[model samples]
Target: MIVITAPTGNIGRHLLPLLLEPVPDGETFRVVVRDPARLSDAVRDRVEVVTGSHGDPGTVDRAFEGADAVFWLVPPDSSLTPMDAYCGFTRPAAKALATHGVGHVVGLSALGRGTPVAGRAGLVTASLAMDDLIAETGVAYRAVACPSFFENVLEEADSIRENGVFTDSVAADRKAPLVAVADIAGVAAGLLLDRSWSGTADVPVLGPRDVSPNDLARIMTEQLGRPVRYEHQPTGEVFRTLVGHGLNEAFVQGIVDMKRAKDDGLDAGVTRTDETATPTSFEQWCTETLLPAVHG
Candidate 1:
């Protein structure tokens, strides 16, 4: 049996279909979710459902039972400190994996583990620490390390459509890798299905190439057939905006610190190679995903 957590989330939502398109014979799938209603009738009919927050010890205890491999993902929680949001949320699951004797685990994580700024990179630091916690379980683990997602641009679709502009806390020319959620899910699916690998490792899913905000604007302009532009927001403005939205102050600071670290090349540590590079490019994502969100 293979278990999936946060099955309704961005990466997990995409990951499920990839795993289900042609279910392996003699292999069963299970999902730990907050609401069974969120799953489609087709998916619900096929997989075992353990309803509750996966962060809860009771929920994980039930979810991990009789599981051979697990796909682990922690949903974003802006109400808590970064450590609590990542490490704390995962502590229960870590113990459950050991108790259940699950052999393999595929986890969602971020880039910047060994970088100079990793210690101060806030949320990324917490996420890497979470990887350590999982590795200690002695399960055959693969942390799908990734950079900022291309889907993040979807959050600013309105700004792009109405004002022809999108914003971020990076320099227009500073280049960094960005990946699609589907690609991240694809990597996780492969790991979950084939558990021959033993020790823990990071499978960095860098996109086709490093892209700057200016590059994003240029691509969006061409793809959307509209004059789109990039706006660089000051870190202070981002902090105030997020905090004003009633997010925890510490969480808000974590965002700011993460952005600062990214701008300083926190994600540049990994070299893009055939093994690490994913198929989707920022331009392709804009045409396929962002274009729809902006005009839909």
Candidate 2:
């Protein structure tokens, strides 16, 4: 059996189907979700949906019972401090997997994880810590260190529709690779199913290419048939704008710092393509995913 945590999330939603497609007849696939009722009927019918929180030791133990491999993802939201919440939640779950004798673990993490930055606010730092913690459990592990999500730009779609522009604190010329969430999930599903590699592995999911905000704007314009522009917000003004949108002070500061780091090329490193590298181009993602989500 293959157990999946956070199976209702963006990456997990895509991953479950991939994992199930190759299963031989009569095999069972299990999913751990906080609210099993929220899962779509199609998915609920195909997988064993177990209700539980990833942070609860008892819940994780029950979910991991009889499971051979697990796909784990940390929930990303505004409520929790990334470092404390991830460690507190994942530690017990990792222990459960260890105790249950699960064979493999696939963890979702981020790029720029191990690299130190002065004002990082510990988001990526916490992920690296989680990766290390999972490694200590002695299960075969693959950490999907993904770059920025192409879907992140969707958050600004409303503004783009109204203002004919996309805005960010990163310079218009700074280039960073952004992978689609679906690609991250695809790579993760492959790792969970293979069960061939041992020890800890860092799989960086670089999208098809690196593109700047200026390039993104051009792509959007060409695809949407509208003259969308790229605008660089002043660093001081960026924090105020984020605050106005109801972000907390700490998160707003973190966003500003992350943007500054990106502008300085902190996230510009490119890793050699791994076994799980089916790259999604920004244009391909925009046309097939982003545009439909925005217009439909």
Candidate 3:
């Protein structure tokens, strides 16, 4: 049996369907979700459902029984400090992992290394720490180290529509890898299905090309049929804007710190070789996900 968590989240929503597309013979799929109603009728009809938050040991233990491989991710929480937020979530699951004898785990993480800024990279730092805690448990682990999601642009599409502009803290010309969540999901699903590899693996899922906000704006204009522009919001304003939208102080600060690191070139570590490249392109994502979101 294979167990999944966060079945309704962005990557989870994509990963779940891939796991059940054919439902391999003699393989059982189960998901531990807080609310079963959030699952689609198709998903409910196919997989065993364990309704509860996986952060609780009781919930994880219940869903993990008779399971060999598990899909694990730490959901965001704004109430705790960065260290507590990640380590606290992983502690219970780590205990359950050892108790249940689960063999493989696939997790989500970000890319940054060997830089002073990476040491204080707020949320990125916490996520890497969480991956270590899970690694210490002796299960074979794969943390998909992703770049910023193309899906993130969806959050600012409204302002883009209204003013022909998109805003961010990253410079208009600094090149950075921006990935598609579907590609991340695709990598995770492949790893989970084939249980041959062991030890710890950090798979960097950099998208097809390096792009700046200026490049993103140009692509948006072409795809959306409007003259969109890229505007760099002041670093100080990133925090205020997030707070104005009612995000918790902890999360708001984490985002600001991450953006600062990005503007410092945290994701510039990997070059776009065939080995580091993922299949999705920003232009393609704009066509399929962005265009439909704006026009339809």
Candidate 1, which segments miss by more than 4 Å at Cα?
A: none
Q: How far is candidate 2 from the true structure (C-alpha RMSD, Å)?
A: 2.3
lDDT (tens digit, per residue) of candidate 1 on 81-127? 99999999999999999999999999999999889999999899999
Top candidate (lDDT): 1
Model 3 CA lDDT for position 170: 87
Candidate with the greatest TM-score versus the true structure: 1
Model 2, 68: alpha-carbon shift in Å? 1.4
TM-score of 3: 0.96
Please give, for residues 1-296, the per-residue lDDT of candidate 2 as tens digits.
Answer: 88888887888888888877767565578988889888889888888877878778888888999988888887754455556556767999889888999888989976675455623634665677788888899898888987678888888888777787778778788887878988888888778777788888888887877888899999999887788899888979977876788766665665666666667665665554555355778889889987876676
TM-score of each: 0.99, 0.90, 0.96
- What's the true lDDT of residue 86 in model 2? 66
Provide the overall lDDT of each model, using Cα atoms, as 2-decimal numbers: 0.94, 0.78, 0.87
The true-structure Cα RMSD of candidate 1 reads 0.8
